[model samples]
Target: MQSAEGTTAEHTAAKGRPTPKRREAENRRRGPVAPPPRTQREAIKRMRGNKQSKEERRKAAAERRERMMAGDDRYLMPRDRGPVRAHVRDIVDSRRHLMGLFMPLVLIVFATTLVQNIVVQQYATLATLVLLLTMLFEGFVLGRVVNRRVRAKYPDAKDRPLSIGWYAFTRAMQIRKLRVPRPRVTPRDAAKVG
Candidate 1:
């Protein structure tokens, strides 16, 4: 009744059957399977499906970027979205801001720091710190002005608590050529915002 390993075989006749091939046993262990495409056309068709998904992703990204650039509220960041923010951007863009010179001034300060003269370096550092602090104060004042204008224009806006002032101040600080959602108004139109 017992075989070589001392295990009982309920059906003695089944023991006479040949063992399954290694490959067959392995395939069975692997569970469900599908054969790969056997022809070039089939392979191409399968690859096309993958390509389509990649294309879809690329298109979606492009559309999102376009929406962001166009100032679409849904696609814009929380800080940059809404009508009040758009108006703020327009106001900041239209006017000449003192903070706009910050980057260039900082670059000039950096250049000055490279000088080997000890006294000149000390004076340059002092001057740079003073200039940066002055610019910061100017930005704060400009932000307050922009905030006042925004509050006056949109008294009933639900998002009035958003940092519209800081947003305007930062936008104003950026060089016009590098600003996103390009400035719609010129310096001549700056006076009309309020």
Candidate 2:
């Protein structure tokens, strides 16, 4: 039968510190394993394969150090965030993409539905051909229109009109429809209150 103080002292001693062997064993389990010579060789080979030229790396590092020391990062002029316009070619490409995805879906549904319908079955071959041609024509027209609309607002290139493809479609679209919601005019604040 030990005194309360003695038991408390014993408990504290037990919990106070880990034995050296126990600590070493824990460390060994959690520690990184040394790689085999083969693995090391492979890793080195990979690093060499991916390695940039020493001179280029040194130059890049020097530039980075210069930037850090200069501490004028914010003072450095921001890049021009100008809009890029869409050209005719882009409209055509986007139209092609749009139609390519949609037209096939329409054709599949038409084919499946018409394959069983008596009236459609009678003209199935001709109907399919007509659908295909229609889709192509629609694609081209839509693409052309899109190109025009996109070019009208964004302009293919800021300096040159013929720079090609809308680089700023999202921004241009946002600009096209600028609307600030205004508060409703009240009778109390109306002109002459009438």
Best by TM-score: 1
Candidate 1 lDDT over 1-194, as tens digits, reads 88999999896466776999999999899998867999999999989998999999999999998887777889888778778888888888877877888889888888988999988899889988898888889888877887788889999876644377678778988988778766778878977777
List pairs with backbone clashes in candidate 2.
Answer: 85-155, 85-166, 86-166
Question: Per-candidate TM vs. native?
Answer: 0.69, 0.27
Candidate 2 weakest ten by summed lDDT? 175-184
CA lDDT for candidate 2: 0.43
Q: What is the lDDT of residue 117 in candidate 1?
A: 91
Off by over 4 Å in 1: 1-45, 160-162
Query: Which run of 10 residues does model 1 get worst, by summed lDDT?
Result: 157-166
**Per-residue lDDT for 99 in model 2?**
34
